[model samples]
Target: MSIRPTIETRKAVPTMEGAGVHLHRAFGFQDPSELDPFLLFDDFRNEVPEHYMRGFPWHPHRGIETITYVLNGTVEHGDSLGNTGTLGAGDVQWMTAGSGILHQEMPKGNAKGQMHGFQLWGNLPSAQKMTAPRYQDVQAKDIPEVIDDDGTVVRVIVGEFWGKTGPVDGIAADPQYLDISIPPGVKKTFRIDTYRRAFAYVFAGQGAFVDASAPSGVLLEKEVMGQEVNIRDMSGDRTLVRFGTGDEVTVQAGEEGVRFLLISGAPIEEPVAWHGPIVMNTQAELQQAMRDLRNGTFIKPAH
Candidate 1:
């Protein structure tokens, strides 16, 4: 408990990627071991169509995985491996680029042409970098949702929770992705494996994440339908909150509630050589990957 000394403030920085798509990167390209297995997180939420409509055109990915979760729009995607589909609101798509693949994602906004989603890149180890490529698409209804009596809602995306397993599996990173929402004034503590490195991103609402006695991030109380309650500041839309060592995580919702993505996975802890969308363990290996792509041998024989 002492090791988990409460909150560690996350610095927010803006970075661009994928054909002029603007986003605020929570953490990436700085330290490789701090949050291993997971390399980058981009909050590509935009109300203006001009900022996001261009979408992610044809891009090559190797030695990594892309997890796309859409909240309020549709994303039509097609890959070099002969897979094509559209993911609407509440849909999750996990693309494992084991070897190399060319893919494109074009976003079609909601009724108001407003689109919002998050893409998380997971780096693969050197051994599995050239495995067969595949995808796991989970529809909104298929994702199991657990709701507590106290009004806490959790959507299990890629891990087992309350005797239910998520649709995506056999992943190289073995990550746990959960979308959690807690009502105002409810104190909840959930235990996560200490071995896994975890972080949370506040997307919608805010709340205080408490660590035992010390107050790490306190939620400013606000009124919710005449109830005197502290509300979490949702001002930081793409803010990344990295936690210290702790087996259990406790969160208290403010008056208007708190919504965030809780993710954890075993750290790769290996050296990372990242360039654009490709992530590998060695720089030479990355060069070889690019060469292989040009040689038309990136996609190997199917198992």
Candidate 2:
């Protein structure tokens, strides 16, 4: 099994969105091809209620799917289709804005006034761009979790892993989203499909994604003889690690352990015409979508 090499590792950038809500963007509004079939990823976490309570007000999305995973707190959401629900801690809501949809998400903090969550936008292929809107709201209990002997825990959120499959399926990207945590001083390797594009976002503790074959100048931290070495190369909190071609990824947890989201998806490799929340294959199609919104025809009649 070839170990995927770390191509780049960078910290998530702070950004504000949706009526003054504060969040950090891992990747978005840049080169979409870097993570094809995936458009944006935002980490919305705050201890101050004022920073996130305003939430994402009513917004329209088309030609894409938005996956919201709540780590703490709750997100009350309502869509144009009359679908309404609340996503609490560990809950996941996958919304497909195939043709079009308008939705609002209001976040509420927990008892300590802390809110944390992630939202990922996945692109829909041209063929299914205008199919139909749908939702897959999976409760925390319905999702599968796998535990290893060495205290490695993995929550399968969107695809199969460790003999367990996620509750949310039928996604166009066929992506695998996993929340993984490793015990301190543990070394582990994960297998990913060779044809898929994969990345890891570290949100807790420090670790080194190691690959002996990693390209020149790629730094990595690893323990030697029970002594932490190359400490400067450790990746910690809110770091985004992008991997090169391979079928496996290896990581060594630091003294405090490490937790991260490991995500991978098949590439769409299609043209993307994007604006705000709407994504299309061509500029003309994007123009048509705007015209539809202007003419009150953005929401297609249910069949």
Candidate 3:
């Protein structure tokens, strides 16, 4: 099996969004070609209430699906369809903005005054872009967690892994999303579909993704019986690792262990004409969407 090589590794950039909520953006709003069928990934984490209290106000989204996973706080959300709910720690909200929808998300920190979460935007193909809006609110208990012999733990949030299926389904991209934690000094490897594009976002501790063929970044080596060795880069918190074509990924945890999100999905490969939240195929179509938004016709009539 071919081992995926780390093509790009970068730290998430600090950004302000949703009425000045502090967050870090791993990748988005630049080029969508490399990460096809996946538009954006954001790491919204803060220990101060002022940093996240503002929250995301009402916003419109079309032709995409948004996945929000809460780690330590609560997110109170409401949509134009009159759907409302609270996403607590470890909860997940998968919203599909097929045709169009307006929604708001407000954050309330835990007792310790900490808020941690992630929001991922997945693209929709041209055919499914305007299907119908829907929501999948998955509680923490519904998601399955697997622990290996070495104490390696993984939580399947979407798609299937290790004979367990995620709570979120009927997604067009067919993505596999997992929350993985490896104990210190442990080594693990995961096999991904050869046809899918995959990436990992590190949020805790440090680890190295070893490429069987060659190392990607700085490595610390040790000598065993006068033999030279190489190691992979120990990527730390808020780091994003984009992998090249392959079917397998190997990682070795550092002294402090590591935790990250491993996500992969099939590429759409269709032309993407995007502006903010509304993604269409052509400039004219984007203009039409804008007109509809302004004219209060973005939401279609019920049958």
Best by lDDT: 2
TM-scores for the candidates: 0.90, 0.96, 0.95
lDDT of 3 at 70: 98
lDDT of each: 0.80, 0.92, 0.90
TM-score computed on alpha carbons, candidate 2:
0.96
User: Is candidate 2 or 3 superior in lDDT?
Assistant: 2
User: Predictions ranked by TM-score, top down?
Assistant: 2, 3, 1
Clashes of 2: 0
Ten-residue region with minimum lDDT total, candidate 2: 212-221
Which is superior by TM-score, 1 or 2?
A: 2
* lDDT measured at residue 59 in model 3 versus the true structure, 0 to 100: 93
lDDT of 3 by residue, 1-303 (tens): 899988888899999999889999999999998888789999999999999998999999999999999999899999999999999999999999998999999999999999999999999999998888999999999999999999999999998898889999999899999999999888789989988999999999988887544544566784322433354476889999999999889988877789999999999998888999999887888898999999999987655
The Cα error of candidate 2 at residue 131, in Å, is 1.2
31, model 1: CA deviation in Å?
1.2
lDDT of 2 at 123: 97
- What local lDDT score does residue 237 receive in model 3, on the 0 to 100 scale? 96
Q: TM-score: which is higher, 2 or 3? A: 2
Cα lDDT of candidate 2 equals 0.92
